[model samples]
Target: MKLVEITLDYPYNGGETFCKQELEIAEKYFDEILLISMSGHIGEGNIRYVPPNAKLINARKARYEASVYLKSFFQLLRIRTIREIVFAKKKLRTKESMPQILKEIFIYYYYANLLKRVFEKEVIEDDDILYSYWMAAPAYYLSIKGKKALKVSRTHRFDCFIEECYQPFRREIIEGLDCIISISEAGKKSIEARLIPFTSCLSEKIKVSRLGIMKKSSATDFGGKSNKYFTILTCSNIHIVKRLDLMIKALEKINIPVNWIHIGDGELGEQIRTQAKVLDSNKYVKYTFKGVLTQQQIYDFYERNHIDLFVNCSDSEGVPVSVMEAISFGIPVIARDVGGNSEIVSSENGILLDKNITPKVLMEAIRSILLLDDDKYINLRKNAVRKYRECFMASENYSNFFEMLISMAKEK
Candidate 1:
């Protein structure tokens, strides 16, 4: 079966990256797969560019986003002074740029329209399943075209936690889709609460299907080698919701010899550095902002580095791929036990935290895990890899997931 996977960008953004890896894994199930992403950089490979469009300004921002993701992936570079940089760049040369709000709206609409038109023209010629990576505006448009074998929309995120969310608006288009998959149970719940009002007022269905990661990367996955003392590493964008500051606070409170390293860059990185400085660079605490190391380099770091634990402090998540990767290299996680986290760990694999959790509470949890003896540590490591094989092993999970879609397509 030919499956046309739709996404907002190329295999760059987190969701699209998931789709990209899914396609790689699903190849055995689907005869041919075509990708339709507006942030499709047909030119520089990964540099996201809005394919040709009537909305030039929106296209420009797409280019800028593609460039930023490339920088994020390559050198761990941050887009400091976005406006200043845009004015200076060769593309957006004028200082008098459109208001940020208007530009974003335009880009979203432009991408949706461009995708709708492109798919309408292309799918007429190909008979296949339509598996959308995320329930963005583009997904809504693509599902309506002609003769689709199976139309599946996967929910990786819901902007619905806040007022004036767009999730319901997006779902209005796919309430009757063949099958809709949610990344996390939490995400599926949100879809129910938010979309009930508009369910096509239709009699259709959706399902919650999880995505997995490569069992092993061509790049070695990182597992902190230092088991002499517990070392926890958080690999995520250093954003506010990540709550890295609280991790620092927990470290300051815990008497155990501990060090934490944050692997990605974002808006909150400098604040993290300053907080570390305030702790007198605590004797037991060492911090490294390793920027964005390549996947292989990260794996090598895992093999050589002395890390004992992986921690996810994100306030929200869609089953972090990074957590799976850490475990793939035999590192156990002490995540905030939220979202699909439990799907990753339990008493058998690793530890979880409270939702209204405090620093002192977390400090105690880490302390309990770290205090485990050599035998316990070895058992946890063994269990971590077992879970990876039993559950994640992306190569097979991907094939199974797409095969489900492919079979549905055949039935349709």
Candidate 2:
């Protein structure tokens, strides 16, 4: 009857920009949609436009009161907590301290209990689809409480990477949800592997539903343009994992003229800026930092600019939408081969770098692209466009995703 979608700061801040396109598609299928924001930080920027049929619920402030923590302290005795403890002991490596594991377990149950309180107040029906954008507390809570509802959750980088982090009750969450939509095949495989240790037969429920962007009318042209400097572009939050500093260090060593443009800002913005200043002395390297831009603004930038390469040096990813966006414009990419990045970027379209890519390695990759013969470079651009049309086109991917959702809901 209705679809309830849970998200972290969607339609609020610049975060979760990918959700907007999916929501636009989802609104067409679901009669009534409830968009719930569970983020602690809200009202930072303009709230994104919501579909006419979708109702926005700002549950960002939803959390247990200090007194509620005392009252619900007995929740620690539950079987889920025991299972999480055992999972941590067996699966978690020495890098994760016992105290840290315990704290994560406590926080997991704390948020689960908090979501439980929030869900109790909502008027949900048996046939309504409960969709969580991430396999976090919302999905966990819905799986346990959403009786007869077609419960689904989309798993991405942080929530799905168990080997990288100690996520409490991953097995339990997988067991509870009816379907797990992974943004990449690698993510789906990771979830399946996590299920193996528990002898869980829920791998069939895990499916890969790649994220996409709307197709562009025209791809980037590689012909008949003379520019003073070879322009390079990178767009992502300037976080530690993003490794903007690595990109900067690489740019410093380049002998040829380059104009590096960075989009987006984060906690490491100032630090990255300081690191980028080192490039000023290198006449060969010029850089600019365009603070956070909306999705439209990014599209506009791609439309107006001549980007020779789009680079991502992130330590982890879920097939970054930025890459998809670049490929949509037929811009060749040079990204670290991590997560689902390899699935989209390859030798034909772009260069997939090693996960342990250093400044020198990145510089070499950039130089390789810049030095490609005009025919080879144009072919790469064409292949990039072909990849976008084949996999990352929003109309094709999201339509099939929502259609599947509608079919699943009808079965319920």
Tens-digit per-residue lDDT, 1-412, candidate 2: 8989988778876678888888888888888999888766565667887889998887635343675465456777778677677767776442588788767776666666666666778888887888999888777777777488889999998888777777676776788888899999999998787654674655788998888998545646555222689989999998999999889889888998999999999999999998888999998988899998878889889888889989999999988999999988888999998999999999998899889878999999999988888889989999998998899888779899988877887787
Best by TM-score: 2
Q: What is the alpha-carbon lDDT of model 2 when measured against the actual structure?
A: 0.83
**Candidate 1 accuracy as TM-score:** 0.78
Local lDDT at 49 for model 2: 72
lDDT of each: 0.62, 0.83
Regions of model 2 farther than 4 Å from truth: 60-64, 68-74, 77-79, 215-219, 224-226
Q: Candidate 1's residue-wise lDDT over 152-256, tens digit each?
A: 778775432212232223443455467767776766665566554445633236566777776344433333335555678888878887888878888886676
In candidate 1, which residue ranges exceed 4 Å CA deviation? Answer: 12-15, 40-108, 123-126, 159-165, 197-204, 217-228
| lDDT, candidate 1, at 244 | 85
Clashing pairs in 2: none
